[model samples]
Target: MTTIDKAPTVQSQRAGTGTRGTRILGTLTIVSMVWLIAFGLGFSPADRDQQEAVRIMYVHVPTIWIAYLAFVVTAVASGFYLFKKSLGWDRLAGASAEVGTVFVALTLIVGALWGRLTWGVFWQWDARLTTTALLFVTYVGYLAVRRLGGTHEQRARRSAVIGLLAVLLIPLVHWSVRLWRSLHQEATVLDPDGDIDMDGLMLFSLFVGVIAFTLFYVWLMLHRTRVMAMEDMMEDRGLDEALASRRREAAMPDSEEN
Candidate 1:
């Protein structure tokens, strides 16, 4: 009797997608988050006008900043995927969009909570809020387009186009307050005159939030892209095995009747 030896599968060879660099980044993110919470919720002084409601800025501002950054990355990666026809770029774009969508949703939720406290309303059709909602919906659609039934290249091509077009809304959302009348205040940190209209401690805490969220975003991207790569590998392997099985069955000889 002959014995067959089976090779190890991709999953069997690896435990997870994490790496040393990602582990370090994850650690840094956790530390920064702890610091941000301490300062944002405990140390930072309340606004004379907005009072305790201003504390929400730490989370609200950082979330939108990360969301914008993620969307911009998705657009850039999508362009590269279109030009180079590389699956790596496509995976990056998809992962970025997914992360951006989560941040945008968080931004909306936090913004609404802040609004309820400051404006005594949970929602309004203000320019900034409306445009932001549009931005969120647009990226959600982009993510959906990525999952449409088709070949990988086909999906990537369509998604890349949407990713590029969707990012154009970001500028409009950011400047919506200046572009039209709105209940939302103009930029306090990113003022056009390069002046920051925030208390020193509040500003510091906001910056800390930005750094922490950015690190978290990088960590998520690293793991998400690796998972995407593994999924692609498994899919290709399955197809190849199926084809080989069909070929072996076709090559078998028929038995003769007695």
Candidate 2:
């Protein structure tokens, strides 16, 4: 196609394809989540030690991973928005941060539930738990900064700074088991050479859980970005209408003078 002919047509075609692709991915995500829950219920081997309680790890771990993914998106997108002044990047950063906070909350809840079973306590002041709690608080602070900022530029800069700083604490949380030798057990699957030590089916189900949760995150981010865009468009339309009304009012007096 000639360049002039391709412009609008190609753009619309790409938009249509992209929309379809997103819808398919979202459907797949829901299916995967359902499949994971079914597989975990039917196939995951009972933990010899913790018995059924260990099953929650599949949900808890994947949720925390989603939180990590969200923050990474937020930091990178915020940087791009600041440098390029792209609303696309800004909306991405905002969407990711909002979803990330929700995942963080879920992680804490599932973790506490898991702890109640395995640790014999609902919560603890130990190094690992404390550090994770601090990590949550830091993200909350980041969200607060974003909400309180005076302008888009101010929010983007402040949120990006906080996100970059908060990531330093994630490793601290992960390593707290070794750094302080607290009651928290060393990570079983993620530790170097630790081997999953889980049954093959259980591992498979958890893998599915991870995929499901990641897709869920993507879905939430997409929805959030679209909502933000609609809000922005509405605000712009409102402003334009107000300006047009003012101009009409101003012109009417001038017409009378003429």
Candidate 3:
């Protein structure tokens, strides 16, 4: 297989740079998260029933939002790869898939913690739990396929196709509780009968947490892409392979020299 001799320049608008705007956005994210985490920990009161256990929301809700955002990234990257076939898109897709897995795992952990506190059980295999678990497993498979399957482009193309199809789970998760009544609650954002009833500071903190976690997600994806690119560079340039080939050639006496 022919490897690309040079590293591809990764450029995506979602990727932040050293520009002042990016710096300011990053700084704002840090400030917001610091305040949100602090406020959620200290200022926010425990739920009337669940008490301190409800406090887990500070960590849980933000992580779930990040997971959703990650799926969005995966969908976009897969679509881009299908249309443009940019190696960058494939790299981003693969990176996002890994990150998404982390967040999905977090979601499961936090959800179980909350379930234990409120329902007095560690887990219940409810509709929400089962569907979300299925979603996580599906993407984990997506990542494994790329790692264990064919060469770079081939694996990427295959993963992209799988990713696009796997994304159907997102909508299913959103509707699972509606389709089947369960212990897990429906989304607070769009309840049909009433508006979201979050307390003032709590709501503000939650929104800020979303922003903070999304920024964190972007930071992770960029770092992941950079690592993948460096690996690609080493494989493509074949510096060691070329050296080994040269050594092999040297071991044989040249007929002309003789």
Those runs of model 2 whose alpha carbons end farther than 4 Å from true positions after fitting are 1-18, 168-195, 242-258
Q: Report, for every candidate in turn, its global Cα lDDT versus the true structure.
A: 0.80, 0.71, 0.72
Q: Write the per-residue lDDT of candidate 1 for residues 1-258, one digit (tens) a residue.
A: 001111235547656777677799999999999999999999999887778878888888888999989988899999998899987788889999999999999999988888888777788666667777888888989999999967778888999998888767667666864466545554432211122576788889989999999999999988888777777666768888789878887787563332
Q: How many angstroms is residue 79 displaced in model 1 relative to the true structure, after the best TM-score fit?
A: 0.8
Give the Å error, residue 187, model 3: 19
Error of 3 at 102 (Å): 0.4
In candidate 3, position 109 carries an lDDT of 90
Winner on lDDT between 1 and 3 is 1
Cα RMSD of all models vs. native, in order, equals 7.7, 7.0, 7.1
Q: Give residue 28's error in model 2 in angstroms.
A: 0.7
Which candidate achieves the best TM-score against the true structure?
1
Q: Can you write out model 2's per-residue Cα lDDT over 53-132, one digit (the tens) per residue?
A: 86887898888889878988888877776678766677677778888888888988888887788777677655655665
Task: Give the least accurate 10-residue stretch of model 2, judged by summed lDDT.
Answer: 1-10
Positional deviation of residue 113's Cα in model 3 after best superposition, in angstroms: 1.1
